[model samples]
Target: MNLTVLRKDFLAGVVVFLVALPLSLGIAQACDLPAFAGLLSGVIGGVVVTLFSPSRFAVSGPAAGLVTIVTGAVATLGSYSLVLLAIAIAGLLQAAFGLLRAGRWIGLIPDSVIQGMMVAIGLQLVLQQIPVFTGAETAAAGELFSPACLSVAAGAMLILLLWQQP
Candidate 1:
């Protein structure tokens, strides 16, 4: 392996770890799990991905997209152990899909659509952080465009634009 590539990957891994630490805790709380579980999940995910994942660039961590499903499953099952079983079964199913080469269908998506989806997801993440930026206790629906939120969002965008400059 090239030393420069290795160095860049190590730096990226550290950055991902830093970001994933708090995110994992937040995601676990969203799912009604203990904070320790989030930390453990992050660690275990890193180890498993490092050992087994086919792609070095694959990011493994808890995600906001799973929050509703996890919360609902916990509420219905009434036990974390059962939720873990469900997660294990889901993992097995995902592996089965991979083995079946189902992921090849993603190639059918147009590059433009995929890029647009990525931009949408990034915008959603930025919008979701507006309340935090504005120190709001809670953001109600339809209030994301309030002046304070917009100001913070604009400032954030400006900083990102400036930071990306050569």
Candidate 2:
């Protein structure tokens, strides 16, 4: 690649690395694991495999979007080693997709469908946050939207309204 293009790629990578740090830590915690795994994966994707990668300006790292899938895989596999095995398998699949140039299919996704998916994700986040915002003490209770929760939530709203001075 040209020197100017390489410099731009390096600059883009610095931006991505900063963003990836917090995202990976959050994802690792949510996945019930240490943050180092995410860092390790990022190092491999960024420095090691990056030499052979096609995307020059794209910085690679552990994505928070995979938290749900990684956590589910760990629960199903019942071991961290197995979770790593699954990750390896996923990498292979991703390589195969790249080899087949399946990335072209991303253009086929309709904007409406993508927007609907985003809206759905937002709703799910709100539902998940309710318990935390209401000071939920027990995750074992399995009641995300209980009467007590709603009452506590209402009380918090009232407090916010009364405390607002500006």
Candidate 3:
């Protein structure tokens, strides 16, 4: 690579580092884990995967999507270290997926359908949590919005909606 490109990449990396710190911390807090764990995952994704990942532009890190996966695994396995073992298994599965190019069909999805799905996901987040805010949390506490925590979560939610409007 050219020196100019390398210099720009270094500068961009510094910015990405700064931008990632708080986002990673917030994700850890939401998932009920120590912030250092999130930082460790970021470090592993940045260093370990860089050695072998074929795609140069793909973002790999402690993802929010893995919240359910990690939590479920923890509940099943009863330890976070065991969750790391599961992650290794998942990493192998993902590497196989990349090698097989299994995501080749992702581009074939209709834009309208994809857009509709995105809209549905957004609405689902609000609707699913509404029951909690209305005081239905007695059903499932650790769920997206627990019945017990619903009353507590309502104010934060109202603020979110109000913040969105203006």
Candidate 4:
């Protein structure tokens, strides 16, 4: 309500947009979907989820964890339209589960299983991004690695490492 609160909220929104925009675009690229699809989904998901969620600090956006499954779904379904239909059905099912208060059962899941799933997701993301990192499409058969691509990747990694330092 106050000016300070408004400023803080605006800053938070900008930070979230900066992080979420590229994540959404990368997820769409990973799934072999159009870039616009990712951008639209990210915006809609963030707005709708933030508006309807009970939690005041919920950050709902396109999930990086779903990249592998989404890619497989698009491939298997052989159409993005079919994948979209499936996603709609899944959303309905999720809403039904929420209404039924099935979230209470989530505590039954083991921590090790959850950790393993996280590790798997991380591995899948790295593996999926390999081609993009190497510029696989542009490189010839005898020359797979591009110096520029490798330099960019190394710089990105260094930045990520430095980001956690302080």
Please give the range of 10 consecutive residues that has the lowest summed lDDT in model 4.
131-140
Worst 10 residues of 3 by lDDT: 139-148
Overall local distance difference test of candidate 2: 0.75
> How well is each residue in 77-144 modelled by candidate 4, as lDDT tens digits?
99989999999999999999999999999999999999999999999999877877887766777888
The digit string of per-residue lDDT tens for model 1 on 1-166 reads: 9999999988998999899999999889767899998899889988888798889577888777666678789999999999999999998998899899999899999999989877765676666555666646445665644566667767987999889855
User: Clashing residue pairs in candidate 4, if any?
Assistant: none
lDDT of 1: 0.82
Number of colliding residue pairs in model 3: 6
Compose the digit string of candidate 3's lDDT tens values, residues 1-166.
9999999989988888887777677566545568897887788778877787678875556555555556567778987788778889998998899889989978899999989877765565456546546655465565454545764576777888889854
Question: TM-scores, in order shown?
Answer: 0.61, 0.61, 0.57, 0.93
Each prediction's whole-model lDDT (CA):
0.82, 0.75, 0.71, 0.91
Q: Give the per-residue Cα lDDT of candidate 4 at 62.
A: 82
- What TM-score, to 2 decimals, does candidate 3 have? 0.57
Off by over 4 Å in 2: 1-15, 106-111, 125-166
Candidate achieving the largest TM-score = 4
Q: Model 4: what TM-score?
A: 0.93
Tens-digit lDDT string for candidate 2 (18-130): 89778777667667788897777667766755788668545567754466667778889999998998888987999899999999999899999989877765676566556
In model 3, residue pairs whose N, Cα or C atoms come closer than 3 Å (at least 3 residues apart or on different chains), thus clashing, are 132-150, 136-147, 137-146, 137-147, 137-148, 138-147
Give the C-alpha miss distance for residue 26 in model 2, angstroms.
1.1
Any residue pairs clashing in model 2, and if so which?
Answer: none
